[model samples]
Target chain A: MKYSKQEYLDYVDKKSPDSPIWKNVLIAFLVGGAICTIGQGFSEFYKNVVGLSEENVKTAVPITMVFLGALFTGLDLYNKLAKHAGAGTLVPITGFANAIVSPAMEFKREGWVLGLAAKMFTIAGPVLVYGINSSIIVGLIYYLIQKL
Target chain B: MNKKLGKQTIRFANGINILSYASIAGQKEGEGPLAKYYDKVLEDAEWGEDTWEKTESKMQKSAVSRAVEKAEIDIKDIEYLFAGDLLNQCISSTFGLRDFGVPFLGVYGACSTMAETLGLASSMIDGGFANTAVAVTSSHFCTAERQYRFPLEYGGQRPPTAQWTVTGSGSMVLTRQGNGPYITHFTAGKIIDAGVADANNMGAAMAPAAADTLATHFRDTEKIPQDYDLILTGDLGKVGKSIAIDLLAEEGFDMSENYNDCGCMVFDIDKQDMHAGGSGCGCGAITLCGYIMDMFRAEKIKNLLFVGTGALLSPTSTMQGESIPCVAHAIAISAKGE
Candidate 1:
């Protein structure tokens, strides 16, 4: 080693270009806000025009977004949008839909059982596991407080 | 009497001649600057194959067959086939070339497989072990992305330092007999880990190794940067190319005038939106086989220093927080053999 690892890392940091975080963040914010706005539109339509209950509207809005996400992923447009949109497209329900559908479509050749069914959770499985587990922990803490 | 030069360099007594070479590029590569030089460019990434791995295999097969055809020789006439790819178990080379029934040696040097295979094949031919040999390597954008990074459809932002894996293949037929453009020397690189841990910034990881091998080649061959018309590295991209230039300058070798990287040459980085240009086995392979070989045939260059750089890190090793270990092999190609 001509230089220490720290020195080499410092040199690499100096040489390598950094990603445009501000641009990415702005795009992500706009795209995310747009997606949410569309979801709100759907929510309003279902609640007023379709005469759905508040609970039904909540379910209907996400279902519609997930459907659009899966549809865009199937059409192979979501990833392209996400390329520039970054977290704007990824932090929404549509992103969750894309996460599942993308791998499902990709692994379709590997067969349905192991490829599609098994590997479907490659990205979403961790989120589900942690989300549910943390919610359970929070519920338990509330339950203890109520008992006290 | 010894063929071995100072340190890790080998001066081939009988110059290994490059008979013919071919390059097969995918749709993305076809849109690049060297698109016209490629022997064949597929309009689709899948290449009508069922899978990306199979598509990579098809590319290797096409490149090897084309090179052999251009050489005006039957596949059986080729004694050995040195090939590899970015896929696990080198599936692209094995599955692609298996039907050819040529004696095969699978090599692995990450993106440097082209130079590694070429160097080994040239040695075999120069040492009279084989009359003719073929060196080939391929990499697919789809296969490499899914295997090395994330799912193709996974919506994750790639850093600016991230390089697009080239979807292409290149093959060269080398023999004991040919007109010109002979491989005169081989400098085997030592694996050097400069402790770059980021997997996305491969150029940074591999730059130090490229510099070391180039400096060693110059010292062993008693040649300077001015001796070669062009000094090309495999896939060091923009960042690594500049870093390599600085590192070599520190070693008292000024390469600023004639130095370029295959990574930077293959793609129109700004226009194509290729963040750090191109990388992968195919980057060096196709650039050498397509554009560089055409330059040789046109007599644009005489002496050339072709260095293939590779970052040796697996997804598992990277996840384990291991730094990328890199190597670069240099092959001196000249228009005339001594």
Candidate 2:
């Protein structure tokens, strides 16, 4: 009843905070690249020294990284790392593990079944639901293409 | 002043006085800009409590007790206490002040609870119902997140739209006669839903209600934004702040010069990693009780409009895909004898 919507929009545009693009991008890149390099190192060790098949190495690398991530999260060290590393810590598989364990640990006070078990998946729940759904759709499409 | 302005606005004839107030914050909030303004800052979020919930209760208790102490009043002299929080059953307030032995009024306006308590407490003082009243509210980041969003340890990434719940508490002592900011008028808000369903974007959900209340206040009082030295909305972080600014402009009040959102102003968004900004009952309560009240006392600000906005949605409601219903209450405060 006072001013027009256009006028309000302009005010908002002027007031929003500007992100530090160069700094964020540089950190994200360095952190993301570093995580990938570590993952690659694990893969190389599994492939050459462990004498594992390529398929087995592919699975082992992520599993190892995820285990480390979850372990750091359990120790409450991952959050501190994320705080300083910014998106660097978030770019790796460790971030996913941290995400799952953080909320679960936060809710442990409400009891095991309702608190921990239920909330353990709060953030990851949507990701899993959509991941599975889309995978099913992709698998069906692959099947159709193969048949054709 | 006219006691009643319109359907929702009320003006106090005998201006209710703010005798004293206190603010207490957890570690994160203590690191913010208004850090120096608070009465106490907890070294840890738990404040020596066993659970985060209990910690929040202790925060509320400390805030009120400190305010009462600052006001130089005994607990028994306080006629009533008004308090609330973002907890189920309002347990934070109930248990926090159970030992105070003051007649209590539990309010739940989500983040807007600070304004709600002040508005109601002011009315009671103006109506001569009580000689002295205390208004307090609190919120803890760990407890609110666990109750409304997810578990504390959940490493789930918060989107930029998500706001950090402020871990703090604020309390105010209002008396029939005192020297401080005067509770001049207030415009009660309506529950407004712009059909926003995303719980993560609380600011966006609560903006419409804030806009509605501000416009109503302006209309009822026949006043413009320039009438007040400052105009603030509670916890409409960066995102909601923008929305409210635009809405107020549309209502023909250009507040760009003197307006700010408590949520956005409390934290350094880029440096603090506070995504959008701060949200919670404590965000508004601490800002008003600590920052704004100090301004009034020092004569830095003469008159101001503080609109406390809230998103009334439980985790259950949001989980059921229900839209967030929001409300904002606007109270006009002026420097004493103004």
Candidate 3:
């Protein structure tokens, strides 16, 4: 290491205390808490207000979470929040939102170049890759079952 | 008194044509601070290329075409055309010159295309390869966004290192005639990447590049801040511009007075609502074409230093966890009475 542990610590201590770390943590709390509260509210709605099955609501939760993330991400509010919070706004379902929105946002600025064109797939890229692969496997299993 | 032994060399712009420049962005119909959004300008323009491209080409053609008209020289009168843009293929500039009907030589220099292209054209002229040429470049938020940002349709988060796209273009006609404009000096730049930054804010992303170019220009020309009528930097914005001045000052160069940043000068900082004001290659180019031309034509300012800055990162680089690498080029444009 270039600097000793004590030296590194001293350097960091002298560094500005106003780093994004604390704000990022707060963003995690605020966004995470908000999402969690929404989950609880959804569960309650299914359990009491809607009389829906728990399994069904559980399945629907991720979709709603993604939708909320997308909406906030679209409004430019989420991005501004993201600037201050960094990964805090990005780690959860918001990450999925960011994945989709970020690429599109970049491309939107690009016009129709490969950057923008490629961005269309950026946000949902992982979901499609994993989901398609799993579905293909599931379909093969179903086909074998029918043949057997 | 000592005079340098270097011989004079001049290049002319030739075979330059404007094929057609088209793109759009920004808010559609609103006046005020919110319109300061780079995307809003593109969205408002409601076309393809970002504000930087649209603004740059329009201004470029506006002046160049006029100069063409003033000199009574047809587009074909230009033998070598030197041009560039803040784009991947230099499309904004290539397409900008598409309709003018002349040969095109693509040039690339972040924001210093005006000077960079002029330097090239002058070399060609001095070499007797061409007689007249036009050096042009255009920048737009829409085109730049796609190249540097996200698709116009997709929403993305930007780091502070990213800068708002500018909306303008600039072009100049370089001729063999002594009565026309000429490039007085040229200084190349070195790539500088200081790793402490967020990628979304371009001013920070390009600060090091600006510093390097500015420092080199002063050193190479042996000129101080007060030597030029105006010392301008291309698209440094508020943050990068300040950093450039500070960095130069560290080396005993105080450029606050005779120095100006293109990003800071174009739009009203108070009214434009841009966090850092104007930017992109178009920022300086348009200012030069629109205002600087008038000043130069009238012989108001002489021995001006124009430094253009650029961040050399593609979107792929950022997505791949690469930090931004930046470069800048400086050109000195002057009109000494012949």
Chain B TM-score, all predictions listed: 0.99, 0.98, 0.79
Candidate 3's residue-wise lDDT over B1-338, tens digit each?
Answer: 22111222121232122221111223421233223322223334534434445554554455457556656767778777788877777776676677877888998777667667766766666556876777767676666765655544343334333456666555666655464445655566677776533455567667667777776666665668888888888787776777667668877888888888766766666564455566777676666665565666567886677777777776777878876677776666656521
Q: Return the TM-score for candidate 2, rounded to 2 decimals.
A: 0.85
Clashes of each: 0, 16, 91
* lDDT value for model 1: 0.93
How well does candidate 1 score on lDDT at residue A12?
86
- Write the number of the candidate with greater TM-score, choosing between 1 and 2: 1
lDDT of 2 by residue, B1-338 (tens): 45788779998876789899999988888889999999998999777877988999999999999999998889999999999999999999999999999999999999999999999999988888999999999999988877776555444446567899999999999998876578888799999877777787788778889999998899898999999999999999988988887777877889789999989978888899899999999999899988888888788999999999999999889889998899999989988534
* Selected candidate, larger TM-score, 2 vs 3: 2
What are the candidates' individual DockQ scores? 0.77, 0.27, 0.17
List where candidate 1 sits over 4 angstroms from the true fold. none
> If you assessed candidate 1 against the hidden native complex, which CAPRI class would it receive?
medium
lDDT of 3 at B283: 72
What's the fnat for candidate 1, on a 0 to 1 scale? 0.77
**Against the true structure, candidate 2 has what lDDT?**
0.86
The best candidate in terms of DockQ: 1
* TM-score of model 1 vs. true structure: 0.98
**Candidate 3 Cα misplacement greater than 4 A, ranges:** A1-42, A68-95, A101-119, A124-148, B1-43, B48-73, B126-129, B151-161, B178-182, B190-216, B267-273, B276-278, B295-300, B315-326
Model 2, A23-103: lDDT tens per residue?
Answer: 766867787788789999999999999999999998999999999889988987787666546678875788888878887
Among all windows of ten consecutive residues in candidate 3 chain B, which has the lowest summed lDDT? B2-11
Model 2 reaches an interface RMSD of 4.2
